[model samples]
Target chain A: GQQVMQIPQYQHVQEGEDFTTYCNSSTTLSNIQWYKQRPGGHPVFLIQLVKSGEVKKQKRLTFQFGEAKKNSSLHITATQTTDVGTYFCAEGGSWGKLQFGAGTQVVVTP
Target chain B: GAGVSQTPSNKVTEKGKYVELRCDPISGHTALYWYRQSLGQGPEFLIYFQGTGAADDSGLPNDRFFAVRPEGSVSTLKIQRTERGDSAVYLCASRIQGASTGELFFGEGSRLTVL
Candidate 1:
């Protein structure tokens, strides 16, 4: 079975500090997707990386896919209260199914 | 049409009872999925439907859990003899196709509390 593991299960940082969460998968992934779930809300898609060594950014957020396509990371620059949420990395599978990582919960303190 | 929709935003039931949660995915979408998320955890895969039939259901934890998508647009997840451990948020998502680059559309999940 394929599994995606995320590091730093919980993180709390000062409002101005930077934060990063890492995700590793046991098997190669055809594509990897990132999602953010705000407190008391369902997961919302943020970005998707499909190519080896791919990198994409959305404002202060940066996402990277390892050259091997077996790992990914999400980096937030200058945390904000609005960034408080759980970040998940899902590996795309057949039939639109996504296997998710345990997730990293981010808490930003002002 | 706009986004995925789920009913009964919250549910609280006694142990050993049966429960059903509903999901209405985006119009025209061909793929739908169900997932469960415990407190502080990511969504765990439960089942996936391609059109009116289940394309993959290997993530189902046990026989007690079952789902159906007869019409291919809306779906339901049923649990029998539910346990206190069944308390969690059930999420539903839909996509245009199996291998599309577009992100999945998710609805506000159904939170189940087994007492």
Candidate 2:
């Protein structure tokens, strides 16, 4: 079975601080996508990385795809309370099946 | 522009009861997926439908679960003789065809509680 691992299962940070969550896959991936889910809410699409070693930024958040397409990371700068949620990284396979990670939970307190 | 919509936001039933969860994906989107999320866990893939056909259903938990997408649009997830362990949130998502990212637009989800 293929597995995707995410570290720092939980993180509590103060407003204006920074936060980072890492995701790694046991096998090579065709691509990766990031999603966020608020507490008790549905998951929302954030961004997707296709090219190896690709980095994309959206406002204060930055996402990176590993050069080998086997890992990814999401970094937030000056986190805000609105940034609190569980972040999941999904790996796309050759069959087009998407494998999701366990996700990292982040809590931002003002 | 409507997003994915699921009927019966919450369902509470006893063990051995049968239940049906419905999903209405966005207009013109040809790809739809269903995922289940347990408490303190990320969403797990249940099945995916491409057009009117189920492209992959490897994630279905057991024979008690079934789904259908007859028109290539809306879908229905049917569960028979539900068990207490079946309590969880069922999420539906949709995306456009030939999408490079395949970034899914999700519905609020249907929460099933088998008591």
Candidate 3:
């Protein structure tokens, strides 16, 4: 079984501040997908990184995959109240099974 | 439907009861997945279906849980003799064929509560 570990199980950020969450795997990963779940809501797809050392941006959110493909990071710049949610990183298995990380719950305060 | 749809957004039953949750994936999608998520935790893989066949069910916790996608469209997850531990949010997701690494479209999920 493959698993991903996320750091800073809980994150409290000030409005307009920037923060980063990391996801690491003990084994190499083929692809990594990021998701966000708002309070009392279902998880929604954010982005997916497949290439090594790849980086993608969505508005103020930046997603990066490690050169070794064993780690990934999601950084939110100038966080807003809309950024309040739990961010999850998942590994896309060969047969379409997605194993998700415990997630980093972010809370932004004004 | 435009996105995945799940029925009975919430379910509540006593222990030892039988329950069934249904998932309707996006039309034309060939892959469907079931996951369970407890409060404050991420989604845990449960089963995956490729068309009308169960591609990978190794994630199922035990025999009490079973799922089917007979016509390669709608899927139903059944649980017999449920326990309080079985309480969680049952999430269903779908992915188009050949997009193994693509993002998954998820349903709002069915929250199960066992008393």
What local distance difference test score does each model get? Answer: 0.91, 0.90, 0.94
Listed in order, the DockQ scores are: 0.81, 0.72, 0.83
TM-score of chain A in every predicted structure: 0.96, 0.93, 0.97
Q: Kindly list the per-residue Cα lDDT of model 1 for residues A1-110, writing each as its tens digit.
A: 33899999999989989989999987788999999999988899999999999999999999999999999999999999999999999998777678888889899889
- What's the true lDDT of residue A86 in model 3? 98
Clashing pairs in model 1, backbone N/Cα/C closer than 3 A: none
What is the Å distance of residue A74 in model 3 from its true position? Answer: 0.6
Residue A52 of model 2 has an lDDT of: 91
- Which DockQ value does candidate 2 get? 0.72
User: Per-residue lDDT of B1-115 in model 1, one digit per residue for the tens?
Assistant: 5989998899999999999999999999898999999887788889999899998999898999999999999999999999999999999999888445858889999999999
For candidate 3, the per-residue lDDT at A107 reads 95
Compare candidates 2 and 3 on lDDT and give the better one: 3
The runs of at least 3 residues in candidate 3 whose Cα sits more than 4 Å from the true structure, single-residue gaps closed, are none
Provide the TM-score for each candidate, comma-separated: 0.95, 0.96, 0.97
- Cα deviation of A49 in candidate 2 (Å)? 0.7
Q: What's the lDDT for candidate 3?
A: 0.94
Model 3 earns a TM-score of 0.97
Candidate 3 local lDDT, residue A22: 99
- Best model per lDDT: 3
Candidate 2 residue pairs in backbone clash: none
Q: What fraction of native interface contacts is shared by candidate 3?
A: 0.86
> In model 1 chain B, which range of ten residues has the least summed lDDT?
B96-105
